[model samples]
Target: MMTPLGYSIMQALAGPVFPLDMANFFLWVTALYLGGIQAIALMVHSKWLKRTAETFLTLGTVFTFIFFYFYLNLRILSSHLYEAGELGYMGLIHALSMKNLVPAFIEFASPLQHIFFMFGALMFGLFQISDKIKQISLKTRLDSVYAVVAPPCPGEELRKAVGKGERRDVAILYADLWNFTPIAEKEGPTATMGLLNRYYALWDIVVRRNHGNIDQFVGDSVIAVFGLIGEKDACETAVACALDFLKEFPSLQADLADRRLPLVKHIGIGVHAGKVAIGELSAASGQPRVAVIGETVNTAARLDSLCREFKQELLISQTAYKPLSLEMQSHFQPMGEVLVRGKNQLQAVYGRK
Candidate 1:
């Protein structure tokens, strides 16, 4: 549209005798080529292809601008050559083909064009490579963070509740590794950390399989919550997870022994169900960490601590026990009321026999 409009205007001013020169033709072609390349660069979704197209466009613009500048200036400074028409587009092309014989063609195609083009190309390539590296690094960091944090809850509403503070009844499961301290001390930091990671990895599988979310790992303990997203039988699910943990422990220990790492003899798990405040707590790193806090969490931790004294691998409070199916309930026997520290009333605890 602009091409026809410009031609019409030029004809109106020059009485239909407007000269069609090689420079005008070249300018029109260059503009269309650059415009087409820019459109393709914008349309492509692939990062690599988009960058390649953009680099090509940049190089084309730089080289075209340099060539046109020299071409037009040469025409103006040497009118005799233009009048003879030896410096027309085709003539210049012929000169370039025989550039070794024609020194003036060398001036038209200077070393400065190559220098600028190569510098632009190099910087564009470096910037693209740097962006790609940064993207990969960020992805790795986020993967590690997600592995350590709780798995995302299913629904958007539930996720929002967890992010903001909300009172929800959830079955809290606290599992602590038995005899880990001595093993850590004997095995040293690096080996002990590896072993601990293995144990936590196993725990993560069991908890997720039972539809529970692991909130955090504090030292040798893992705190997980079931039904935070409103599962009806959260208590039964928590008890089932504890049982699965016990069932999987022997295999884990055997694997550790095979690897020649320090072995953990047992794991103590406690499950309690009640209302708890679910919210995000700001860490020292200024990131928000999802936290479940209340008396129920404290009770569950205490019950886990009592596992050694009670000679049981799994323990559950009365609140957790009441909601279980009869078959699941039969797996435990009441250990009677015991006054746990930091509680006014004697809490009824049940131990898995």
Candidate 2:
């Protein structure tokens, strides 16, 4: 196809020259035009055009055969008319050879080709637009979900909490969903997340409303701290939160049934109190955070992990209980001394009635 255009361009560039024979002229023209179309296809990144080009090129070979048959008929009829000089008969033959037949073939084939190209272009454009919309919508939903589920960075909040005293003593609580890893293996990843989310939804409301900061969520466990807001009954608040979490878990489990999920949820909560460095850990975007250190944090983990052995859901240490007002201590029932792992001395433990 490019032959026609290339030869014309070459002729123009080199000045006028004698034209080639019919065969050479048509061959070059066909080659130049085909090449130009392919170049255009490459320039545009449209799936429709690419597919159409493949189809058109494949079917283009048939058009050549069609043209050959028509050309032969025209030659034969032209010879007959030239031998007889019957102008009217020649006119009729001319219409069959070139006027009606050739134009009709061109008209029919041109529309089909255009339709193929157009359909391809439209399909490609639609697919691209659809993909972009899906991606944008997914990103937007994820951002919104994160805003609700994840706690805000508390860089400023920690400073304010720290400024309350030379050493800010806060009660840290850790709660782990019992058998979460084993449950995930049994139920699959989708059901496990759904179960975890339902459980978080219940605790999020309880902890936030009780003047507690949801410190962090490690997999299926929740770490919350109290006394950040004020020096209120820190132990009492921590105990209440633990008891409330225990109470609320059952209803949350029932809700999972509606989603075709099993309801096997148990959490072990360990509460301890000590001084901690509080601030944002991430440098990228200024997000506020708090870091709890010392034996208070360690004891909390120790007590929480021991829940399985003791067959209890909530455990409060002596430090966490020491700050409790008389009324708060009255609500807690004493469980005898128990030895914790990595500790030589036995640690006292308490349970809520």
TM-score leader: 1
Q: What are the per-residue Cα lDDT tens digits for candidate 2 across 1-353?
A: 45566655775575354334233344564575566666765575455565565445434434444554444555466567766775464464444432355464455446566457545655665565565444334433332333236553454555665553344677888888778888889999888877777666667777876768777777887788888756667777888888787876665555566457757756788987776655434446655356555566677888898788777888888768887888878877778687754568876888766
Score residue 306 of candidate 1 by CA lDDT. 91
**Where does candidate 1 have its weakest 10-residue lDDT segment?**
93-102
List RMSD in Å for every model shown.
19.2, 17.3
What does the lDDT read for residue 289 in candidate 2?
55
Q: lDDT tens string, model 1, 59-112?
A: 676556655665555556456564677567555443323232236445554677
What are the lDDT figures for the candidates, one per model? 0.75, 0.65
Relative to the true structure, candidate 1 has a C-alpha RMSD (angstroms) of 19.2
Residue 237 miss distance in model 2 (angstroms): 0.9
Off by over 4 Å in 2: 1-148, 155-159, 163-167, 339-345
